[model samples]
Target chain A: MSVLEISELTKSYPVPGGGEPRRVTVVDVPRFVVSAGEQVALEGPSGSGKTTLLHLIAGIVAPTSGRIVVAGHDMTALGEAARDKVRARHIGYVFQTFNLLQGCTALENVAMGMAFGTGVEAGRARELLERVGLADRADFLPRQLSSGQQQRVAVARALANRPALVLADEPTGNLDRRRAREALALMREVCAESGAALLLVSHDHDILSQFGRVETMAAINRAFATADGNSPVETR
Target chain B: MSRVPHHPVALLVRRSLRQHALSSAVTMAAVALAVGLVMSVFSIKDQARNAFTGGTMGFDAVLGARGSPLQLVLNAVFHLETSPGNIPWSLYEEIRRDPRVALAVPFALGDNYHGFRLVGTTEKLFADFEYRKGRRFEVEPGGRMFDPTRREAVVGSYAARRTGLRVGSTFQPFHGLFFDPDTQHEEEFTVVGVLKPTNSPSDRVIWIPIEGVYRMEGHVLRGSGEVYTPSPHEEIPDEHKEVSAVMLKLRSPAAGMALNQTVNRQGTVATLAWPIAQVMADLFERIGWAHRILTLVAYLVVAVAAGTILASITNTINERRREFAILRALGARRRTVFGTIVAEAAALAGLGSLAGYVVYLAIVATAAVIVRAQTGVVLDVLAWHPVLVAAPAGMTLLGALAGVLPAFKAYATDVASNLAPAS
Candidate 1:
């Protein structure tokens, strides 16, 4: 069974001008799927709509037209509040900037992921921090940590609720080469151990090659394919 | 760990405030100042009204020569104003013998010791003059009520302390209601007593015998501005004597109406006043506009404080756009973000109002002694007024209203746009 499935997804933003409004198509994907426990990397240059596709799958952004099913829930048919509930119950997001709340500690940042659910799972957060090699740094605030350590904390927070799918958008974007490779390995190892599917976006070919299955935004996004004359790939 | 889990909104607000510690402190201080001003205004107004009304509760009616009834009560009871005119001393005898009269204490004004008023009356003032309900004047230790026949005096506690006059001290009276050393009466009186503190306007007066005033060199009934100096052997006539005003206590509260009507009908002889009613009406009539203006100013200050909170939060929300987006990406609903901002505002107002109330009490505690000494009104620092509750509640509502614009901004934050690498 697929943990995340998308078909005919489209997103366009209205650009206001002196005359009538014009539509700019940002994302146009025909079909995409991530099987349970599979690790897939989506590589795209800037403005290729990789982040927009990730946001659409995570239910963080509404698609213009599509059917998106994440962990058995049809996200496209649900209202915003219900989509938020579905995201909280089944999806985890790790941003490129390691956007930890400034004054909160590592443990608190992790616990905050579960705060919107029924109750905060502090024990689970602590266990996840330990799994991410941040057990000794749980009480350290984001400013106190180095970039690599902050990224590790963000990874721990993303897995705090043990969701079925984890989304990582250039999680190593701020780290040195060695630290980026190490952070990638840590995220993949943690996700595998927790039996969660991983969908990561990166523009680096070296990191893209590390995943078992790699898909290019030019091969998945119809908007990029049409603009660049790159042919779309068939879904596996 | 047994720590209770806080809501996400609460935690976020806590973190946000902690991140912006200086702004939060400044906002809270502004709120505290506004709340303190409002609370002090309400409290002082209540205490002042209480002191003024309570001070006159002992006497039901005041009888003096035809004049403003409020002025008659102010001069006779509170010693706050000069007497309008004097009624003949024979009227005191008639009022004393009236069936409806319970107690009739005569007062003779127009004399001063230093700045304190010098009242001339019989010992009936000490024995029967009720300062508060069921409370009468008592002489302090090592002192006794002065004899009316000799040149003796009884000074109120405040007056004794202020004038440095003890039981054996001698002081001459000034010729008028205000002290003038050049116009001092030649006859001096010995302070035979110091009255205990009564927390009334009477606390600032010196009591002398009515004969002492009449026998003075310049107080004879020769009309206005006349200075009469009789020879040592000359006799002072009884018909020429006068008393400033008479404080009356009716035998039955119902007799007040009839007695007031009777006195007013005396046709230029005298006018009667119900002390409490007349003083209250006069007080509201005279200072009412100022009070309302002050109250409006205080509320405007509170509104400005709310506006300050609104501006502070809205200004910071621009920088917090990404943080709010992060929360939404972590599955927090827009309402959650909205409520977090609103909660932040309410928390500021709540804490600020509480701090302001503490500040107000501190001020009142520090001012209590000075107020009592100056106005004979003791402020109860811990006394609860409705404004104590209403002020904070209003501030909280104002804070919520202040939060609306910022909360809406937070609610409309674009999660995907903020989280994108382009951002």
Candidate 2:
């Protein structure tokens, strides 16, 4: 079953007051889908709104006009509160800067994401932190850790709830190349092992080759096509 | 399959408070100072009111030669200061004989030992006077109220306690050649009674009969041949009469105004004053400037403390904004964001109020000794109520107002944008 399906997605932001209000139309998607257990990357230029589409799918940002189905739930039909509940139930976000809560230790940061889950077990949080090779640094606050270590904590937090949809927005933007590769590999392995549909947004083309599926923003918006079975150009 | 979700909002707020512990302490200190200032001022005011009321419980009016109302109350009620002029004792007797006057006690002041004043009045003075707990002077190591026929005296609580005077202790009123020369009489009076400590001015006075005071004055003049009595023990001629002030108790306190009007019309020698009204009027007049100044000072202190709290919270918001955005992204409702900030402000205010209250109590305790020495007013420093101590609700309100600017900034944060690529 498709874990996520989007049709006719559009997003517009109004320009600041000046001349006639200039509107930036970012997304004009006709159709897209990611089946369960799929690993995909959305590659685009800086202004292509790959992050925006990821946010919409994760229920953090609302789409201007579209129907989005994630994990068999029609996200567009849910109110803001219900959307939050749905996102909490299924989505895990790995922000680029690591965005680990500064005050909390690495273990605490991972456990925090599981606090709202009905079956959120502390053992799972500890196991995931151990999986990220951060078990020794579990009690160390985010500020005390190095950049790569912080990113590992973020990854641990994303997997803490064991969600079905994992969204990564430039997850390796601030990392070195080696750390970036390690993070990308770890995320891929973790998401596949957990059976989560991973939709990663990134400008780094180096991370895209490992993913089985690729969609450029323009192709996803129906502006281009390729010979592959996937409607959007795979680019490789 | 039913999927379990993460609960991030509660976790975030709890961690936020722990992370900002130092800032929270600073905010709490500010709140404490504001609360303490308000609490101290209110307590002092209440104590002062209680002391003044307790000290002047009895006494309907004071009659004397025209003078300051404060002076008149001090002389007639507290027996601490002197009246401006003397009224004839015969006039006091006339007033005492009236059906409308329940009891009239005449106070004749002209002498002092050390700095404590000596007051001469009849035994009726002690009978009419009442102190707390109904414990009067029992004259336990001394004698009783001296007979009006004898040149004997009764020592006040403080005088007897300090000077070690017992019954039959004789003291002479020896005036120096210069220095006011108010009491030049060398008449000796034996102490017949020692007053119990009343914690009022009565504790510091020496009392004798009016006739003994009159006899002493006549005896002083007799040696100089300026004035002579028929004999040393005989009463002085009526022409040499003198009484410093008269304290009159009315059958009805409500008749004070009428009594004052009637006495003011008397052609002899005396002025009438309703002491309670005069003391209130004097208090009102003095309160205008002093109360205003104290209140202004208290307000400024609280305002500054509140300003410090506001600054602390405002500075913290920038560092916390990203965290707030993370909370919003993690499914924290907008009201939750609002509530967290408000809770922080309230906590700071409550903690600060407690700190300030402690500081206030310490100050009052240290200053109480000095205050008693200087003004003879004893302030119970620890007398406080929780509701009275929490006087910074206004300061807390202002702190909340200051917190709103930051909370609004936190709530309006774009979670996706903040969590997006920095480049």
Candidate 3:
């Protein structure tokens, strides 16, 4: 069964009128799907609505039109509150800049991820941080940690609630090759270990190649990449 | 990505508060100062009232040769100042013998030591007087209870303390109505005893037998050549006798008001006054208006302090926008963020108000000894009712208002716009 299914998804923005009111089309997805337990990469050039698409899936931003079914819930049909509930229950998000809260320690950061849940998913977050090789850095504040360590903390925090779908936007964008590869592999591994599907957005082709499926966004619409990083070839 | 709180928000709040410790301290200090000012005033008033009421516990009313009600009180109850006019010994004898009068103590005042007044009244004056902490005129070592013909004297606690006079100390008291070193008479009297501390006007008095006062005056006015020691059989002349005022204890508390009116109608201008009523009126004038004015000033100060806090917090709201959005994205409700800001405001205000209350207590305590030593008025600092109400009310109100600005900002945060990618 598909973990994420998108059909005829459309999103647009209204440009404030100086002379004329015009709508800017941002994303148009005719069809998309990610099977449970699959690792997928979402790649696009600058201004390709990669972040917007990621935000739309994460329930942080409302899409103009779409039929999005994630983990059996119709995202397009849910209200803001319901979307929040769904996000809290089943979704994990990693930002491009590693938006770690500056005030909390790595462990506390991971722990707080459970605030929206019943309690700290005991051992789950600490286990994830340890898996990311920052277990010793658990007490270090986010600002005190290196960029790589911060990202690991974010990754640990993201998986704190053991969500079913992990959405990462440029998850390794700020790291060197080794750290980037380590972060990507960690995300893919955690997704599989936690029974969640991984969907990552990145501009790096090296990172893109790790995923079995790739989606490239354009101004007019979204297109899927062939496994070899070739042009879009439609699949039924 | 994780849960709300997720360590990030908590970390942020703690670090932010620590980083701005100076600001927090300043706010707290402002609150503390305001609270202290209000607390000191309330404490002093409480102390003053306690001393005043404590000095005259059992008396229902005081009657005198009426002039000023305040003067009557000052003479009959306080015994520290002159009465408006003298009531004849015959009249006092009549009141003392009346069936309606329980006990009448006559007060004669006309002399002083430095500025401290000397009151010569019968032994009944000390016997009838009550004081705080259940104290009375308990004579200590060397102090004498008035022996009418013995010419012995008892000095009040404060007077003895200030002058370092022991019981049996013999010296000629300054015989003038007010202190005059050069004009002190040659008549010598022995201090027989010292009374205990009584935080009242009585604390600074030198109580002599009413007869001693008259005799002392006679010796001075008639000169040594004309005055001689009286024989045990000879009667003191009537022309040399007088009393400043009389303190009347009626048959019952119920008869006090009626008896005071009857005493006032005795073809005399002497005014009768209730000590409690006079004290209430005095308090209204001294504390009521002053306290209201001070409280108004405090409210204004709190308003300004709150504005400064609001400005500081809201000024940082932009920097906190991303933080708010991130928390919201992590499942923080708009109301939650709003509530947090409000809570922060209340916390700051609460701390500041508490500090202010402490400051007030310190000031009152500092002033107590000096006020007592200088003016003989004891100011107590431990009174709690006003402190309890004012500190919390001031802080809560100021803090609530301060938080409203930041909470409103937090509530209005739009997640998508705040987290939007830079253009």
lDDT of candidates 1 onward, in order: 0.83, 0.70, 0.69
Please give the distance, in angstroms, between residue B97's alpha carbon in candidate 3 and its true position after superposition. 3.2
Tens digits of per-residue lDDT, candidate 3, B68-162, equal 76666655565545567665566667667878777678777766665556677887877765443355578876455868776667887887888
lDDT, candidate 1, at B116: 85
DockQ for candidate 1, please give it.
0.40
Order the candidates by DockQ, highest first — what do you get? 1, 2, 3
Indicate the worst ten consecutive residues by lDDT in candidate 1 chain A: A227-236
Task: Write one digit per residue (lDDT tens) for candidate 2, span B251-283.
Answer: 786577677677766433567767554574567
Clashing residue pairs in candidate 1 are none
| Model 1, TM vs. native | 0.91
lDDT of 2 at B406: 66
Point out the higher-scoring one by lDDT: 1 or 2.
Answer: 1
Deviation of model 3 at A66, angstroms? 1.5
Clash count per candidate? 0, 9, 23
- DockQ score of candidate 2? 0.27
Task: Kindly provide the TM-score of model 2 when superposed on the true structure, using C-alpha atoms.
Answer: 0.76
DockQ of each: 0.40, 0.27, 0.25
lDDT of 1 at A92: 84
Model 1 lDDT tens row, B1-423: 323246777777787888888988888888988888788888877876776766544788888888888888777776776789988867888898999999998888888988788889998888987878789999899999999878999998888988999999998888888778888888889999999988777788899988777777776663233434445556656556678888888887678778777777645678888655555667766997888998899889898899889998999998989899888888899999999999999988888898998778877777777776655456788888898888888898898889989999999998876775641
Weakest 10 consecutive residues of candidate 1 chain B by summed lDDT: B222-231
What i-RMS does every model get?
4.9, 7.6, 7.1
